[model samples]
Target chain A: MDKLNEILLNYADVDEIPDSASFRKDLGLSSFDTACLITEIRTVMGISLEPADFIKCKTVGALKDYLNTK
Target chain B: MIEKILPDGSKVTAFPISIPQQFMFFMSAQYGAKYPVNNIGLCCFIHGGADLEILRDALYEAISRCDTMRLRFTPDEKYKILQYITPETEMNIDIIDMSDIPLEEAKLKLQSISREDIPTYNCEIHKISLIRFKGNTDGIFMRLHHFAMDAYSTGVFLRDASEIYLHKTKGTAYPKPMRPYLPVLLQELQYINSPQQTEDKDYWFRSLSEADEPVFTDYMLDNRLTQQQKKNPSQRFADIHSGSPEAGTLIFSMSEDESKRILSVCEEKQLSVCAFLSMGLRTALSVFNNNETDVSFKMIVNRRGTVAEKKSGGIRINYFPMRSIIPGDMKFADAVNEISLIQNDIYGHCSLSFWDMLIERHKSMPSDAKPDSTYDSIGLSYQPPTEHIQLGSSPDEVIWFNNGASMIPLYLTIKHRTTDGGFDFIFEYRKDPDPVYDLNIFFTKLRGALLAGAEDPDITAHVLLKQLKITDEERKGKNNG
Candidate 1:
């Protein structure tokens, strides 16, 4: 979560990104930014993810669930 | 007789158009006879009930405010000059009843209408129509030639028209008239004849003389040679100036999240969005051309805000060539930064007209060598965020489409939509037999390359090229031959 917060910081204010916040609708992460976040997640959390997966998991909590499954 | 009252309460019979307008008029006369070139069209869909009479009056009022809408082109020996006329000439908004037609059929009809050509040269270059659909939905189609207005002017017209419509509907006072095009036109004329133009001419001549030959031409030549050797070659050839060419558009968008990330990257790198996108395009093209070191393409720059031409309401756009050389081992971030610097330098001198550049290039070309007419094969335009206007109860949907014939083979317009904070990528390309490049595949790879670069900014461009595995399939035949 802290790592996710760090990556999100590049795009939005730290306070803006919450567990329930949607990356696209709420945070307005562009396609390139989402790609960067996906790469960062793989590098930091050691979880390989696809852009489609991130798109599907719109919120941080959903993303965590997907990561747990992975 | 309709009269235009000057600032000092004097009447003027005729006025000259701006330099850009004159340029467009001449170019259209030379090239736009077969198809309507440089025509901009907008379709605004209004929902709920709105008075048609009030809407008509509002449109007329909008036209009355801007001299550009009331302009007609007069041909001279050398150039077709523009003259503003009075509204006494009949300018009726064509109202079509689409309520009786099926929705699909109505849409098909609308598409056909959009393809229809308007008066191109030495004529009135603006028209408006209203289409009434079933269930309280109405659509307004406004078409303006590039000589009269640009993309920015379209927004301004819509905003003012809507404001006037709202006021008229409520029986309120009309809004103030917009800044006329005469002042802007005069300003542009002064700049065109100034010493700065001479300096610009010199700068362009030096730049083009020093620049490398376009890489796409080489790619096409290689492809053509390969095709000639094939036993079952495709019947179609790659011709830049093929008559009866078909224009097609491919649109893609970046998600809000992805847009935000790119913005963050740009902000951190001190690069403009346009520069960042251009780098991505350069990198992608390099990979596509089998790791070509240098990629060159023309880019359209709007000179409306420049010191020479500060007024914003008319056509002030010109195309200039941009080249980026990529080292095989350079990191993606470094490549982007380097390209950004090059872009800044090119943009600083973008005020130089493309026509002037061509004339300069033509002078230096050897008598035996063919004149280079291939620069227009590809172009990139980055449209900044435009002011959004609301027409009565906020439109349920707004559709903007370009109806003009494409002057280039492949033109990419990257528009940043402020309402949604998203990017709209429009790729308008000409149809050719045996296309030099597969546009769909190219766009997909472009998106992938940009995403990959964003993910691992430290990765060298060479590695990205390897991943993409772009090769000269067209060159394969030539090698065999």
Candidate 2:
């Protein structure tokens, strides 16, 4: 699986996430769950994303765009 | 309450006390305000060929013989909890039999049922079902409320129940309630006001200042008391069997030489085996936590008196925290001796309540923090060998509660039965954290520490490196062979 898809899959029990859906709204992720997702993303992408960075990215597409730049 | 004189001519006060109320007060307070509303009842699941009528008749007569069994709670005018003193009475037993249903499946159903429906005041003695295992005679499963009876008392009740059941089967009057826990309860109450109370209070204060409050959270374990909740049975069993690799019992089967070495160390230092073990564990855990400073947790006191006098056996089960400050770099033997002196000086404190300490120091704690932050550690208990007393029936092995993820995070319990030649070391992690991962780490470290202690009684932080010797040997063999 590609990096983004793998990260999304590990983040939720549900199999798929829509491109249009925000991570928090679509996945119903708690703060701890969100942190876990970020930690996994950092490890996989080898990028340092501060906790504050997660605030701007709401949806899968937004997160993907941000990750690609970093 | 009446005044009486002890054999030593010391004045002792006795109470025409409320037995059930006392039971309820202690149990509810001790077990965190959940289950067995009164906190002193049994959840006995008995199975037999006999129908509901036989079970009811047997239970009725059994409760009748035991007057205290019918004792209930009543509040005094002051509303300070008091027991309703009842005249010796025979009460009808409430028995529920689901024998017509399949046995194994019924057990699962009954176990799945929550306490929400059961009457809080009354104890449950469910007639779950009769078991017909291929190899042996039949047996029934039972769960008792801690408030009604402890393990020892429960065993007696079961033994008596069995005797009564057997006699009834052959058509005989049920035997009398053999031994009651009431006297023990009464004796323990005495300590509430005794010199022991002062010591217990002090210990509680110190422990609370150091430890933290119990935080309740969800446990990762999928094992729920619901029929719909299911996991692969084999996997569940495997997890339980492995226990936390680091957490449960760490036994050190001493070679004759090693045993003698330990004895010599204890004798030279005038320490008990239990005291020595406590110091060892503290040192090991301190190192595992990477504690740059020394810390201490509560240790269980059997409350049994010394050999010459029954000083310890007033039926009160008490534990108190005795702290020992370790030099960040102290050797193992020195640390062990430090524990011995601390224990000796504060042995009197064990009888005090750990609750008062937190209340006294509540101001120092963060106002926003919930209770239990005062102490972060729990007591470790050890039960010495005693002649097995045959209670109502032979006692089943006691199981420890899987205190799922916790708020306070860590508790360690060490209990052993000489009769059974078995010992258990339980580490309770605050389940509120990632319980599975925290426990996985905590148990592994604790187990390593305990095993290291066993191999070298005089183990120190410096000597911990020696524990890798086992792996080293394995590796060497692999290379040579």
Taking every candidate in turn, the Cα RMSD to the unseen true structure, in Å, is: 12.4, 25.5
Q: Model 1 lDDT vs. the true structure?
A: 0.64
Chain A only: list TM-scores of all candidates: 0.80, 0.86
lDDT of 1 by residue, B1-481 (tens): 1234444454646556665666677667766546666677667777774677788888888887766677665533433353565553357897888988775676666666666677744455687888888777787777777777887677667767877887877755565456656666666667766887888788778776666544442223234323432743432112355544456677788777776677677655544567678777776666555677778777777654421122235677787777777888998888876766565455545555667777876564434334544432468887755445555364335555656456677788887654465777788766653332465556656676777766777888888888876446633543554
Best by lDDT: 1
Give the CA lDDT, 0 to 100, for residue B162 in model 2: 53
Q: Report the lDDT tens digits of candidate 2 across residue range B337-410.
A: 56655654455444445455446546445464355432334456554323332222344333322312221334
- The candidate maximizing TM-score is 1
Residue-wise lDDT of candidate 1 within A1-70, one digit each (tens)?
6776766665543345678987655765443345446656788788888654665686888887887898
DockQ of 1: 0.02
Please give the distance, in angstroms, between residue B479's alpha carbon in candidate 2 and its true position after superposition.
Answer: 33
Candidate 2 structure lDDT? 0.44
Error of 1 at B351 (Å): 3.3
Query: Which residue runs of candidate 2 sit more than 4 Å off their true CA positions?
Result: A1-70, B1-70, B84-137, B155-273, B300-315, B328-337, B360-371, B385-411, B417-420, B427-430, B465-481
